[model samples]
Target: MQTEPNSNPNGQDVLLPPDGDDVPRVQDLDLNLLKAFHAVYVEKNVGRAALRLGMTQPSVSHALSRLRLVFRDALFVRTPGGVEATPRAQRLAGSIDRVLRILQDMLDEGAQFCAATSRRVFRLHMSDFAESAFLPTLMRELDTRAPGVVIETHHIEDSQFNMAIESGRIDFALGHFPHASSHFHFSELLQERYVLLMARRVARRLELDEHFTLGLNAPDGLHFIAVTSHPQATELLERYGLTSRVRLAVPNFMVVPAILSRCDYALIVPHTVARAFSTPGDSAMFEIDDASTWPVNAYWHRRFDADPGHRWLRGLLMELFRIGAREPFDSWLGAPLDLAPDSAHNA
Candidate 1:
């Protein structure tokens, strides 16, 4: 049988003389591969490491091959049962384990956020109405500190709201929730109040009782051109005893002012949304103060609760919305800042 010299309690070889360059040095190795090596050691299988890395099995095999060359030994030997660590690998086990842990900690810390150097992409769900008021502020924040990060918005619809989030089709949805789903986690974002969008001249002439009679039955099926990215019109109509006789329905909110210019039609939207739709033109938005308030929320799949990327996005949103802060009543929406916890809950 082949035998090797044993080490003393002080980790010094007892049988061989000390060599000049025998000290362990990690500087020469590719530090990036440490994550892959750690995964392999923990799983004890190449296939699992590949899955964890979101790579192909062959790719993991190739990385392992490279690790062997760097370590100058077959770190793991295939036996009748499982891969076993060799003497050199055994000596490395402790140090490699610590190195892998430190690397993971660094990655986790980096993800925690340093706006100056971060380039994270945050996927958010919102309606065109919410986007009109919030996107500008969010963009300003992105350009300042989190300049490298980009936001991908998902417009939430009543038909697919539940499935889209539960199945991971999107990262998170921001809007009202009729009921909670088992597959998702919900956090309150803000309260949305209904409003009316009409020509300023028409707004002045219509009495409060006849406010619903702008040639539109309610909010959805109106005789005038309507530009809506979400179902806020339909929702607003449902709250009141009205129904819209929609003649035109466009998907973008930016087109509303143009559409409402020639036609004598109006749109019933959220107050914040109406503010966004307001411009120096023939049409403008008016708050429907009598309409019921809807609670808006941020929802995500339960499965993503533990993911690092998902958590990062969730935290960023909470910071942006200041979840407890009340919606601004000063009109044009305020700067993106934290809302006090006590006042954030009310609409």
Candidate 2:
């Protein structure tokens, strides 16, 4: 191994070899050699790989020779028809493809986004409530603007979401997430305050006004329906001394409306969800006076902060739901519900 000159400014020890080292470090590995390896692995023939790479056969051969020397293996063996990749070459193919794709995406970021032509797939992590409230409008916009784009949604727990975003399994997470780490980026999309949801008949029977107050004590004989995932909602219930009042605990907000319809239980949910569940004669929504407003944000890894496709998606969401936009989201929901002026405070 040939050692290069130490160029450390902070007096930290750094050991590296020159580019001609027998066993190259990651920094010393030639990108051309890796590209050659990928081409060879895909084409299975040196002549064809050279053609695909827009290089001469001898140049590709030389590049393959360097790759073999660096990897210490004959990555490809000659065959009668063409060539076959060795076990080592086969193992390197997947990683090399992923690297090429990342590079391509980075290159594409510099170009303007053409939604009409681009076929990008965006993966989102959202709760059931967010899906119910936002997906309809989001899909409509996608259909009109980016007909070729695909959207995949996953309902993942917050505990495992960081890993999912880091691994690129999820492109964006839209919901009330806690503070993110330095490796992640977040922007507030909407702010939602919790509200009480109950059947219209139940509300009428209890003599609850439009602005019903829970008072300092849990309402007598009130069976609370709790969403298992919302700790803040549960905490509010506990603060109002309503924990013991919980009779049924459900996994998500999807079934809360249905559960409240047949039963007389009161559910604490976001005002957006309350409005979504409330119908003219089925359910009624009321604002909680002392409720703390939680923010619904779009979270992504810091790595994608500058990605054009990701930025476009985030921009579209912000345009539609940010504090002030041309159209009211209530119109998108096709309901005459009145939204609080300060409901979606920007953050």
lDDT (0 to 1) per candidate: 0.61, 0.75
Lowest summed lDDT across 10 adjacent residues in model 1 is found at 337-346
Model 1 C-alpha lDDT per residue in residues 1-347, reported as the tens digit of each score: 23335332222333333334455357646764666666766676766777898887677666655665555555665544445566776787788789877888988874565666777676677766667767776687669867788789876667877777777777887766675476678887677776667765444344323333332234443344444555656655545545445667777777776666666666766666665555543444544545667777778888888776677667766777654555543422543222111122222
TM value for model 2: 0.61
Question: TM-scores of all models?
Answer: 0.55, 0.61
| Global local distance difference test of model 2 | 0.75
- Once fitted onto the true fold, the runs of candidate 1 whose alpha carbons sit more than 4 angstroms away are 1-113, 155-163, 177-180, 204-252, 260-265, 280-290, 306-308, 323-325, 329-347
lDDT for each residue of candidate 2 in 1-347, tens digit (9 for 90 to 100): 65543312122333434455355468656779889888888887878888999999889877876666566656677777677887877888899899989988887767668888889999999887888778888999999999999999997766788899998999998887774556888887777878777876666666665455664745576778999888878988888778888899988887876777788888888877776677655666666658987678888998887778888998998877675432234656666553221122211
**Alpha-carbon lDDT of model 1:** 0.61
Clashing pairs in 2: none
